[model samples]
Target: MAEDLNIHDADPVEEFLPVYGMVLADPALYHLAVSVGETLDRGDRWAGAIRRQLTHAVAAHLLGTYTRLKPAPETVRGGLAPWQLRRAQDRIRADLAQAIDLRAVSESCGLSVSHFARAFRQSTGIAPHSWLTGERIARAKVMMRRKDRTLADIALACGFADQSHFTRAFAKNQGTTPGRWRRLMEPEARHATMP
Candidate 1:
């Protein structure tokens, strides 16, 4: 039918018919088809435009449903390939003091930004930014062990904008300000340093 209309794009119904068989068994598809039929039967002035619009709508619906029903390929189901994950992680860790550009990281892994983000989340169970923030926090924790290192120094080293930013993020993640956290860790630091 699309061919008769000189449409070069593959017809959604024809593409999925072999796998899904007739769509009439699906109530939504059945209702849509019935409605389109009735609209055409009425032979109103807007029939031509309505038919075109509804036909595309039906095709889009079928395509969406087909994608939802289809299982992702096994290799991609678990998310990014091992090499991609390693590359993305290494890139993100290469310089914690610098702002992370997700676009650059995704490109390094030969993926689009959205795809890389989704796959990264699937592989690590967290968004890339969240992972980066966690890493920053972890690094800040280590730096806090050195009493000589001021919160401002640690914040700059961990890619935070300033002491305030570090304090906010630390509080959000650890439920305490960086100063309070350092105080809390001071005892541990003392114990660990004692021979």
Candidate 2:
């Protein structure tokens, strides 16, 4: 298996099939086969339901890989190490409300900014700016719990330049305005109490 291809990734088969030529792994699609073997070994004659579940899991796990195993691209190789990833995430969390400086992050990791950006993308599958935006949105979601907090205040706290910017970004990511999301939260509480 290619180093970049996680069996649990969204599309493992497609990921592996591309690098099938360069890879040294056998083409038997062993993961699914092993799953079936283990499932049958339970030896319960009445295990039909369990067998069905195991089959479904195996199918989902081997999706796309059976026919077209592939190799990972050279450029995608060598992502940040575990510690570096933790450090980078920590730094991003620390400055969630501020503009992240790529140069500063790279310097902190002892890597050039461009190198850091490439490795970060390969490792995380998203750009640093995109990740920062996602983090901001997540933070906004948490802060939205305070029903009394104005959207503008939440926006500023989450590092949006202003209320309009925050609303636009929030709407873009969340498929609704902050006010609407907040309203949805309150109804959940009402439903919980009723139940």
Candidate 3:
């Protein structure tokens, strides 16, 4: 039907059928019928227009049948409940400086690792590992404000194994090296202290 009617995303038919009953409640058909009458009165290309409208009118029914025939995909299990999500986030935040075990994390939520991972992604719109990394980066940014701390110290404190690992992760997350980010923050820090 799409090929027959030349329906494109930019120029597509909008569904005007809201009611479902024994008869099709097609407001689109009514609108098109009115348009055809108006075009006929003006002596325009009413024939061609009516043909296109008829194609859409037929295609709508065909698509409705297609929808009815197609089997729906089985949805994954429900997302972590709100309390479960909060508990997971708290656990992640508390253990941000330590190595995370997926099994352990999932167990805390009373779920299998696969289910927990899927539900975590569903709740947060990010994979668990990615969310963890982002949290680690956020922690690093807060520690970065202190000029006394070395990058190596900050790295280990924020759950990264080494300075190089920290640098790569921080660069990817912040779009700059940690040292550069610190340097940029210095002026802002200095200004904040003044009256």
User: What's the number of clashes in each of the models?
Assistant: 0, 12, 0
Cα lDDT listed for each candidate: 0.73, 0.69, 0.70
Superposed on all Cα atoms, the candidates' RMSDs to the truth, in angstroms, are: 20.8, 11.6, 18.1
The numbered model that scores best in lDDT is: 1
lDDT of 3 by residue, 100-147 (tens): 688888899999999999998876666888878877977787788777
- TM-score of every model versus the real structure: 0.55, 0.60, 0.56
RMSD of 3: 18.1
What are the runs in model 2 whose C-alpha is more than 4 Å off? Answer: 1-76, 189-195
Would you list the rank order by TM-score, best first?
2, 3, 1
In the range 1-195, model 1's lDDT, one tens digit per residue, is 333333332333433422322444677787778878878666667987888878877766776565222222234485999789879978998898887899999999999999999999887767888878867887887778687888999999999999999899888876668887666654555567879
lDDT of 2 by residue, 1-195 (tens): 323344222233322222312654644546656756777767676566767766665554455444332333234457887677668877887978889988878888889999899888887777888778867977887788777689899999989999999999878766779888777666556567873
Candidates sorted by lDDT, descending order? 1, 3, 2
**The 10-residue segment with the lowest total lDDT in model 2:** 12-21
Report the CA-based lDDT of candidate 2 relative to the real structure. 0.69
TM-score for predicted model 3 compared with the true structure: 0.56
**lDDT (Cα, 0-100) at 168 in candidate 1:** 90
Return whichever of 2 and 3 wins on lDDT: 3
| Candidate maximizing TM-score | 2
Q: Once model 3 is optimally superposed onto the true structure by TM-score, how far is the C-alpha of residue 86 displaced, in angstroms?
A: 0.5
